[model samples]
Target: MVASIHPSLFDRMVKLRRDLHRHPELSREEHRTTDRLVSELERLGLECQRPLDTGLVAEIPGASDAPTVAIRADIDALPIHEETGLPYASDVPGVMHACGHDAHAAMLVGAAELLMSRPEPPPAPIRLIFQPAEELGIGARSMIEAGVLDGVGAIFGGHVDRHYPTGTVVAVSGPVNASTDGFRISISGQQGHAARPHETVDAVVAGSLIVMAVQTIVSREIDPTHPSVVSIGRFEAGTASNVIAGTAVLSGTIRAQEPAVRAHLHRSISRICESVGQLHEADIQLEIEEGTPPLVNQGPMVEVARRAASEALGPERVRTMVRGANMGGEDFSWYLQEVPGCYVRLGARLADSAGYPAHSSRFQIDEAVLPAGAAWLAEVAVQGGRELATGMVDDLEAAGRAS
Candidate 1:
């Protein structure tokens, strides 16, 4: 079932991906990228709408009222400067396709072309979402707010991973990514000369203590069975070497796989900071900003993905996760909260030792997987449509029997 993409389509995908890579744009600033996508989609005979300033959504028509499934590809680049040195390296200064989003967008375009190339329209309707600002973890939510998923029944999104070899897919059914939240601690005290330490509340000492104590939230407060992370990324205090600092600010992120664990970490963080502040006699204020929830793949959608993957690339290449975990955050979870969906991790890793992870300046993808990814998404839509259609039949039969 899973064969290579047509030669002409594959050639177009490579060229488009390289062109996008060379002209990388930052989050919320993808005007050029969006225009490129609109042009390509329109050339394929599909009408696209630009609801936001930077992203676009195009629907592939199918039978009337057929179940709708969507395939999303983020179209944003990171702030990292290019270091890959490839001919297609980013031309934009301080911005590069470090996260494989260029490939994501191109593969989605390839998927659209593949579907259109078919002799008949899809069994189900399909929506292609080219979203921006994904690096900031707000694109998915913002797109949803703009009504991208209005009539959508199921959705699927994927990230290119360097961990596994090309032609591999991770179709896990449980929580694969963590929920991310952030915390800020502000401490106030009296300023005084360094020689007179006793005159100041010593905010630096208090903030330092808070940072060290916050570390214990994951190790001591939470259950050891669950995975979590709490790391202080920034700390600012004091203005001079000779003066005692009167104020300090600390900022960091929080991650967890379980809701209880996420809540527990938040509670523990506040308690620890407050306790340290009281113990030091410094006024402390804690602020928590929650981010996206965990990417928990629905069982049925996972089944759809797995079945489609097997049909597209063979069962041996489809890997279903069991007990492993990742602490990274993905905005795709926002869509899952509103609809049943699956988040897939396609293997784009190459054999080179210089291989770097996503968001790294040296990160690169094996271009060969572009067609595979496109084919996989199309198969999922077809299989998902058939599955839903079958379930609908079963429901009607059961209702008839009851009557």
Candidate 2:
């Protein structure tokens, strides 16, 4: 099933995304981006609110006072230099929509246009949320604090993944994305000359041992079939080659599909750091910063998204992802925690390039997927709202009869 939105509206969506790409903003600094979105959403005659300085919400009322269903698009860009070299490439230095948020924002606006164009308004309320700071992983939380999900029964979101073929859409039923947690380890040892290394406990050596042991948490401690990753991305120690540094810092991230696995990994990481320091007779300090939890798609919500996908794109284009829960985290998980929702991956693989992952300077998306993404979201909101309202009415009536 292909989307039946007007061609002119589709063209407008493409142009809007391109314009956003050229003038990308970063994280909480999305003033101009929010301005453009507010203008478009207001033009569609929806009620708009800019609760966060950079994020905004727009509502489209339906036929009744049914619960709201929210559809979100992250508006923030990344601090990456553009190498795609397109004419509409980012004009701002060190700022670009390398993660396809430009596309997400524009598509949601397109969805707003389509939903408003209906001859008769939707059956239940719909909210279009333009969130900022997704790159920093705080936008969704900020919006939630601002009550974007108030009175809403369900939510829907998507990310552009270049790994999938253009026009392909994927949404998994269980844990579709991993929980992201970060840790920092500091080891303090006696400073001494490199020539007399035996005199110093060698904090660098201790930190290295901790990093190596942390890897065993995923390989041995966790089930082999369960998805998990412990990567030591940063290690810093001596300033000069001749002297052993007094302290070393090691920082990395933990990713896992299950909450139990995440907890186990964190516990093991702490144990490894402390054990390594004891063995080397060095003082150790561990700091772990908790991040978003794994996004587990509610079974019913995934079914709704799957149906919407088949309706907006052809059934053949709607794929069920069986493997590869993205280790990257999304704050959208915050919304899912409050209500049932589904987050999908909209394929943005360019026609010419093989496969370039997001956050890379060369990241690009196939422009053709814009309408499909937008239409799918708008349709899902309308349909999902109706389902939720019907369920609520049925339960209320049952209660009244029992009374």
Candidate 3:
């Protein structure tokens, strides 16, 4: 099925992807990247809307809003510098396409082209959502606020997965990615001379104790069956040697798949911080900032995506996730909250050697997966659009009889 994609179109995608990789942009700053996408999408004679400062919404007319099925692709880079040494490496110093968002946007455009060239439109319109700020964990919500989901019935999206080999796609039915939320602990106490140990309430000691206590939240407070994480990524205390610091701070993130586990982690962290502070005679303040929710694919939408993968690349190539649910967070969950949709991982691993993971300076994907990703996305749009249109018609009929 991949071979059926015109060689010229595939080559165009490869070249354009390299161009994007050459000059990458960070979250919410994808102006150049946005311009390039707008040009290509307009050339295909599709309607375009710049719903956000960067990124766009390209619409391909079909049966006139019969039931708009959406396909989303993120288009933001990372802060890491390029280390892959490819000829098309990042041109901007200290910035790179470390997460394969470049490839994502490229393949999405390829899908748009393939759909545009069809002899006739599908049973419904298709909305191509080129979103920015995905790395900030807010792009999906930003687009939704801009009315991207207006009149939309179903949506489909995917990410490049290095764990699986190229030519394969993993479509999971539920709980694919975990929720991400962050917390900060501030400790305040007395400061005094180093010699006056009893005179000072050492915040450093209190902060250290708090960090250790935070670890027990996942291990003891939460159920062992439900996987959760409490990681203190940053800790600050003490100003200089031989000084009892009066203030300290600890910051970290929380990851959990289930709602109960997520809430439990938050509660346990607060309890641990307060208890530790009281034990050490220090004032403790805790703040938790909510981020994206866990991505749980609906069963019916998963079937649509899985069948699309099978039809696009053959039934043998389509597969389910081999590992358990991942702890990583994706804002795509925000879209699923608004409407039913399916999210899959597009395999891009080239060899057994474990290459640099996403967000690494050396991160990269197998370019060969470009066309495969495109084909899968295009197929899902066609299949999902038809289903949504039929359902919409059925609903209208039921309403008419009642009226």
lDDT of 3 by residue, 123-201 (tens): 7899999999999999999999999999898999999989887878899887889999998999999998889979999
TM-score of 3: 0.96
lDDT tens digits by residue: candidate 2, 107-215? 9999899888889888788988999998887888888988888999889999887777767789778787888888888899999999999899898888888877887
Residue 340, candidate 3: alpha-carbon lDDT: 88
Reference-based TM-score of each model: 0.95, 0.95, 0.96
Give the whole-model CA lDDT for all candidates, comma-separated. Answer: 0.87, 0.87, 0.89
Regions of candidate 3 where Cα sits further than 4 Å from its true position: 1-3, 400-403
In candidate 2, how many clashes are counted?
0
Backbone clashes, each candidate: 0, 0, 0
lDDT against true structure, model 3:
0.89
Of the candidates numbered 1 and 3, which has the greater lDDT value?
Answer: 3
lDDT of 1 at 401: 100
For model 1, the stretches where C-alpha displacement exceeds 4 angstroms are: 321-323, 395-403
Better model by TM-score, 1 or 3? 3
Which run of 10 residues does model 2 get worst, by summed lDDT? 1-10
For 283-303, candidate 1 gives per-residue lDDT tens digits of 999999989987788669888
